[model samples]
Target chain A: MMRIVKDIMARRELLVMLVIRNLKIRYKDSSLGFLWTLLGPILMILIYAVFLRILRIEVALPVLVTGIFVWQYLAMCLGDSPNAIIGSTNLVKKAAFPRLMLPLSIVLANFINFLFSMVVVVVYVRVAGEPFGQLALLPVALITQVALCLGVSLILSSLNVFFRDVQHVIGLLSMAWFFVTPVIYDASLINKVSANPDTQFWLNFLFHLNPMTGLLALYRSALIGLPAPALYLVIPSVVISGLVCLAGVTVFMKFQGRFADEL
Target chain B: MNSDIAIQVEGVGKRFRLRHAGTRTLKSVALDMLRPGKRTVRDLWALKDISFSVARGKTLGLIGANGAGKSTLLALLAGTMEATEGRIGMCGTISSLLELGAGFHPDLTGRENVFLAGAIMGLTRNQMKKRFDAIVDFADIGQFIDQPVKHYSSGMYVRLGFAVAVEVDPDILLVDEVLAVGDAVFQRKCLKRMAEFRHQNKTMLIISHDLNTIQSVSDEILFLDHGRILGHGTPESVIGQYESFSRGVTTSDLRREWGTREVVLTGAEFFDDGGRETSKFKWGEALNVRLHYEATKPVGPSVFGFALSDENGRVVNGNNTQIEKVEIPGLQGTGSIVLRLPSLNLASGTYLFSFSAHSADHQVNYHRLDHAFAIGVDAGKRFEGVCYLPCEWRLDREGAKP
Candidate 1:
């Protein structure tokens, strides 16, 4: 792992260049261009707010909007990472580099989009007289999310070379994983759904098990001035994301030797 | 591990497990993990036990037929894939033009792709920036550098690709059949650039079927056959073996033909004096060439010709209806043309024959087949030079004897 990091560091310029390329290609031939990055989450938040409203669950718009922006990063990374290696077959087969860059570039590109969306959320909340939450906690949440995302992206991109069906599996898994995370709902609602105390404990435990859980809390705490529930879960999220990241790098390097052949 | 060696390989081999189509999917992989069943996977050793060391500042050329593992070996050296067995130790940085523009994204502008390609080759942004103008200038696609590569012509694309590859300027370069693209002028330019690389003391390993290019540029040649090294030595010696190896098996596999479909040469055969079809002949043996053709269009004043050229592509003898005053007024439907040789006077060497039918004015070729047939002449070193002239040596004792 240290060696891989060193290799990436050595090729950091290429990584940055590829990230720019990812963003450039994403906007190519599209008239809307950068607006789409901001528009996508804004639209998703509105739609989800409408759905939650129809379900008669009252939630703050800032909370739901912030969640959507964060979820978009995860969703975008998942969508693109599976095809990252296969899509850059030309680079993977022709040029020699730390191929870990392929997925890293994708995650970085989406992270940039996520960052763009968050700036708008932060400004609108500030302008609308909504208090800024614990902004210091944002970096911790951001780092945790980036690590988790980097891990998942690495694993998916590497595995996709062996099993092409991995692309579709990522799609289904993202949708299923999205509902369990409080991307649209608040974590406090865990009590309303389950009358049984034992069931509520397990439900809360299940939510925290998602590495996104603690990271999402930080985002909410920092963006909307809401107290982060189960904020201590950040420790487990850190550990799990760390393990997932380690596993991801392991799986990636284990199969990366075969990527040229399999691709 | 000699410091003088730029590239070294020892017992290097790549084995591919040829998996069936059904085994590629997730369901099959899951089933495979569950059952651990014995699957019928064939092992294809693309390269095996290959060992060669190229000295610094030297050029090594690879010659082989298709599927001879030349590309696989180059890919291994380029660090595209690992060798399943043995080791390849490369000194200094390496660059490979395995396929020109291999990583070029069409949606990106040529300038962007140039930088991207440079990055892929391990060049930093500032390094690529310093060399960017040189690359674009070498590519010579004026003003197209700002435009996406998809909008560029194929030649422009190749030029940009070749330009970036060489400009990255690694210590060791691996070129694989990339010089064959672009126009003749650009090819000559590329060869000159490669020669300059040699003068700059950059070691190179080039793979090209064009023996002339390889012969002129390579300091040494490595001949491969079916994943194994058959010969490795000076260009003269290894190319000689490769030529004979190819001549012995010049069955339609080596045929190079291109013509309009108005008329086509469907088949060709070589026959000895006894009417036995054979590719081998004595230096003075009578030989006959028969060409079967199918003409889809009616032709007038058609001239059929065949030229016998030596391995160096020098024509020792050529004949045709126009030259022989036997012009056909028309050629319609299927027919055969025979060029009967009373004596094959070429010296002992491998010769290739090309057949063509064209207008009497040599304006248009109804059909032309080029170097489609290879015939070997056996003279037992009886004579020197290309042609076996009808002359005898006389030992007359008229002389200044010391």
Candidate 2:
């Protein structure tokens, strides 16, 4: 583990370049360019606001905007994990460096996008009349999400090299995962589904089981006010995210040696 | 471990698991792994129990046919791939030119990629910053360095790749088969840089199927045949063994012959001093060559030529009737051209010969047979180097041998 860290540290400059490359290439040919980062969340907010107003649903603009931004970061990273190694086939087959950097770069690049989205979320809070008390906790929320996504991205990227079907599987899985994670709806909406107290508690536990459920709640608290997550949900979420990140590192290292052969 | 040795390999081998039935998808591959030693898995050793060591600052060359495990060996040395068995011990920073433009992102500009490439080779941003100007200067892409590499020509891409690696200052460098891409001018530049590497006392291991490159750059050549080391020695003897070993395979099937065929050479024959028709010649022995030609139609101002190429198909010597100022104007019908030589001055080695008959202006080739047959020159006089120039040795100064 220490050796891998040294290898990555030695190649950190390359890591930075790869991150920059991902960001630059993501919007290179698009006319909207980097604005697409801002445009995506703004458009999501506009669409949700218009619909929510018409439907008489009073979901705050900050909640909707922050959810979309944080979800986009994890979604984008997970969506791209299938191609992380396969995408840079030239680099993987030709060059010898820390293979972990490939997926890590994708994770880091999305984190950068997520940071930009945070700025947009802050703006939405001030402009949309949302409370700004927990805004100081933005760093904690962002860091947890990054650790969680890095681990997930690593596992997905390395597995995709061996199982080409992993690409199609990831596409389907991300769609299903998005729907379950409450990107468009709050986790509180589940309360109305069950009438029994015991059933509601079990349902809420299962809902928070999705890593994104806790992360989304955490991001909402930071970007807006009036949503302090339960201690049980937030604590396990942080611990699980850490474990998943460690497992990601372990899984990526396990498969990276055979990447040249598999790719 | 010998401190003077730069690289030492011991019983190194690579065994590739050839899944004959092609279990690529997840379901089948998982099943194969679950059930070990299945019929589908066959072990084919690409390289087996190979061992060799290079002393510090010495350049070693690897020569072999395709699938002789040359690439596998190189990859092992470069650490791009690991050997299934044995160990590779090395004593310095190593740079591999296994593939040029290895890590270059096509969307990135050349300037950005320079730093990126340097970083790929494990250099820091500060090191790359210092070497950036020199690398760009060496690549010589001018303003194109700022443009996306995708727009650059293939040669430009290669130049940037080679240029950045050159600035790396590695203690050892590994070069794959290509030391011969790009135009002639750029090739010479690459060769000059390679020579500079040697002058700086850097150890180099170069693998090339092109015998000319291997023989030229290497101090010693290691020949591999079917994953086994045939021998390692001076370039002369090992290449000789390599040639003789592959002799039974007959290179004629792959011989190249192309021409317009306005006139056709029916046959070509070589003769010795006593008028015996043969291909073998001793150093300083007399040689005679006859070209039998039949012109399909009348041709004007024709030139008959023969070129002698060394083992690498590099022309050692060539001459034609036009160059010698002997012209046959408005030739028609079957005829023979005989060229007589009083003595041969070529160094001892096998050489390939080709005969061509073309128009004097050289636009139209009536008949051109390339790499037709090989001739051997016996090491009669023990003369060294490419040519056996006529000369005598004498001691000019009277000195004491203390």
Instruction: Please report the candidate that would top DockQ against the real structure.
Output: 1
What is the docking quality class of candidate 2?
medium
**Candidate 2 lDDT by residue in tens digits, B235-337:** 9888767765554233363357778888998887889878898777887788888889999999988898988777777888899998898878867899899
> What's the lDDT for candidate 2?
0.83
- By summed lDDT, the worst window of 10 consecutive residues in model 1 chain B runs over B248-257
Per-residue lDDT over A167-211 for candidate 1, one digit per residue giving the tens place of the 0 to 100 score = 877888999899888888887787788899989877777778888
Model 1 residue A227 lDDT score: 90
Write candidate 2's Cα lDDT for A1-263 as tens digits: 79988988877888998898899889887899989988877787788789879998777656677777888888788888889998988787667788899999999998898787777677767888877767666677778888999999999999888777888888788889888987777779889998999898888888888888888888777667757888787777888898999999999988787777666
- RMSD of candidate 2 to true structure, Å: 10.9
Q: DockQ for candidate 1, please give it.
A: 0.61
Number of the top-ranking candidate, with lDDT as the measure: 1
Once fitted onto the true fold, the runs of candidate 2 whose alpha carbons sit more than 4 angstroms away are A47-58, B20-23, B30-41, B251-402
Span of ten consecutive residues with least summed lDDT in model 2 chain B: B246-255
Each prediction's Cα RMSD? 11.5, 10.9
CAPRI tier for the interface of model 1: medium
